[model samples]
Target: MTTEASGTSPLNHPEPAARTLRYSAFTHDPAGGNPAGVVLDASRLDEAAMLALAAEVGYSETAFVTGADEQARRFRVRYFSPLAEVAFCGHATVALAVALAERLGPGEIVLDTPAGEIPVATRVDDEGAVLATLTSVPTRSRPASDTELDATLAALGWSRGDLDPELPPHVAFGGNDHLVLAAASRTRLAKLDYDFEGLAEVMRRYGWTTVHLVWRESPELFHARDPFPVGGVVEDPATGAAAAAFGGYLRAVGLVTSPARISVRQGEDMGRPGDLLIDVDPHGTRTRVTGGAVPIAEAGGPRRS
Candidate 1:
């Protein structure tokens, strides 16, 4: 099936089924987190078509819910970036969880993603908005080669001196692979200008999803940014995948002991600031990423064919 939604098209056609796609994984305020396009019901969309729709949505990622089973809790979920389909997306998962909570009532929901089964727990906050926590897949970390590290640094226009001596280079995988590079200074993190195509080539070669550029502000807090050229987006405002990977990065390197929580402030550079909360547990292999989301106003326009 082919489906489309147009937010800005002069030409007109039959009214497309409109679902308010919000930028979730945000905090209480809508503008304070990563933006995600949420399509609550996407049974009318096909694989190719969903990819196109996600591209048109122009966010880091877009989530489509195909259907829900009898219990009204289990759903088949798919994620698409601007460039292609992704196995999973954490922020989008949070957005979907909140959306589902509103529709199905506050509780837990099982999302069957291509990567694996994701269980999202949702609850109403003090202000009565839905907040969600998603348990990620088993996370693992591996050392990054010297050559790979040098090349990645070069692509980002940084030298070895700019790297934080405490946190060395490591490639971590939660739901996806991310190359974690800690910045020596917040100044370095604020000034981000990377070779998009060059880095994309390197990432594709290494099967990396995003380059997790981060600065350790404190023991329990960090500032982060993610370059996602592979997904046809320059940056990801809020990235759950990177957060999960970071949890593993901290653990493998002994930066953070088991059973800890970290706050990641992202999207501040983009003017759409957002927050991501990551829970690290030593008992289990999986990392938990949590956040909140809100819906955006629907834009008026014709359907895109």
Candidate 2:
């Protein structure tokens, strides 16, 4: 493994650091999707250093891979945010899958992540990016108590009336926990405002990764946003973990029944539009999330000298 100053490495410093990571998760379009930072080799960076680097890069989450030789395909992985390390991250996984596909040619890759072992299948499409699908760990869902739900609603300045009747309130876990809240109207989903510090405090106390705010646009599609105050971010335009958790939520609550596939269109409201696919099985333990990613730019490409 090799290390360079933040943004100075061959992969990161062609012009801006964003070019180094080759993924636009949740969408096939390279220009219209969630961007994630993926480092194929992270052995050179320690935990604190990785966290600092992630903070500097400022993506919602960055994936670091360690303990894998060049000859091997598997990697030990971890994810970090600006403030701390997390148990799992979906977008980063998609980004890593694309990066691996770029290097090893399109194929299936297995990652030993902090949350669990995730298997990803990758292939390139006419859109000119490597598409990857990650099967998440077994999912679990539980209804939030009235008190907990009240505190959550208060943090978002939302009332019980704003919630969708079809999807009830629940805390869903794919890898980490998310409070799933469905908005009754598309207008409510568009108008996103929340208590920053207040919500952060509550989220930290409850060990929540994000608040999944969604409005179903159609039976197979939805508009989504995530409040990640716990990670010190106000919102995430595209969230893979929340998407996986939502699939579990839908199945557990009978919203989608069993053996359903759905697409989530996110980041549109934020202008960095991305799309994600979710596959749920009535009997299978894992849920699959799929999307495409591209190298933001070429390594050693032209730069402003």
Candidate 3:
């Protein structure tokens, strides 16, 4: 069951599977950006079943709609990586929102996740594509310990000199925790070769969902890459949670003025380029991440163990 990417890994547990939809988030094209599995209705599934289904789907993460309030357009959603459950996932959230908008009509929806209540707004673009904007929960960030930062750099084969001294390294949290490391140059960020096992160990120990590797291209433009070993993925193409966390990191370090919109370009090195738009409000603590999603395919079958 294990692939060459990881040795001797366990397969997804066998379970009665539910119908799942596949979509690519953060890109208008179905072939671009990050792909996510969305279970529009998962009320009948339990946590173990959800986890198994997520592994079967084999995406970076899958989103499950556990509860729904049709009258208010509110839902209880849960996110599960292949290996375990995550508090929240931005791209999946966007995908789900767009999916729902297509059915329920573009508007606002409330998602109650383990992390907190997230407000998502949906709109139809001029081209008739559904776009979603998710406002993250209150965010906070703090400096990473010197020891932890050093170990992480070693795992990524990065050094202090390669880092953007002004940005530094910090553990930032939007809904999920991510270690934010700003590279001094785009070239440094592009050449990503990390010890998967080592980085995974460090992330698990620190409760980090991903390592947000970023390089500022301009005052409001950035290039980002996320190492998501904790999710059993080599990298994430468009990480909304990490982008939100990075927005928080920028605010924490006084790198960005408030009420600003930032653009993040990701997945180019991996050959699936995508764009994520982040909005920071000077009056609010939450950051908003916006993107579009398109259906890729549909799947429904029992997962083999």
Q: Name the lDDT value of residue 217 in candidate 3.
A: 86
Error of 2 at 209 (Å): 0.5
Query: Residues 94-178, candidate 3, lDDT per residue (tens digit)?
Result: 9999988887789999999999999999999999989999999999999999988998999999999999988889999999999
Worst lDDT window (10 residues) for model 3? 1-10
lDDT of 2: 0.79
TM-scores of all candidate predictions against the true structure? 0.90, 0.88, 0.91
lDDT string, candidate 1, 136-239, tens digits: 88888988999899889989999999999988889999889999999999999999999988999999999999999999999899999999999888888889
What is the descending lDDT order? 3, 1, 2
Highest lDDT model number: 3
Cα lDDT tens digits, model 2, 1-305, are 22333544333344343223545567665566666667765666789988887776676778887655334456678898778899999998988888777766888788888899888898888866678899999999999889878998898899999999888889999999999999999999888888888888888888889999889988889888888877757777688999989988888888776588898988877777888889988776568999877666532211111
The worst-scoring run of ten residues by lDDT in candidate 2 lies at: 296-305
Candidate 1 at 97: error in angstroms? 0.6
In terms of TM-score, which candidate is strongest? Answer: 3
The whole-model lDDT of each prediction reads: 0.81, 0.79, 0.87
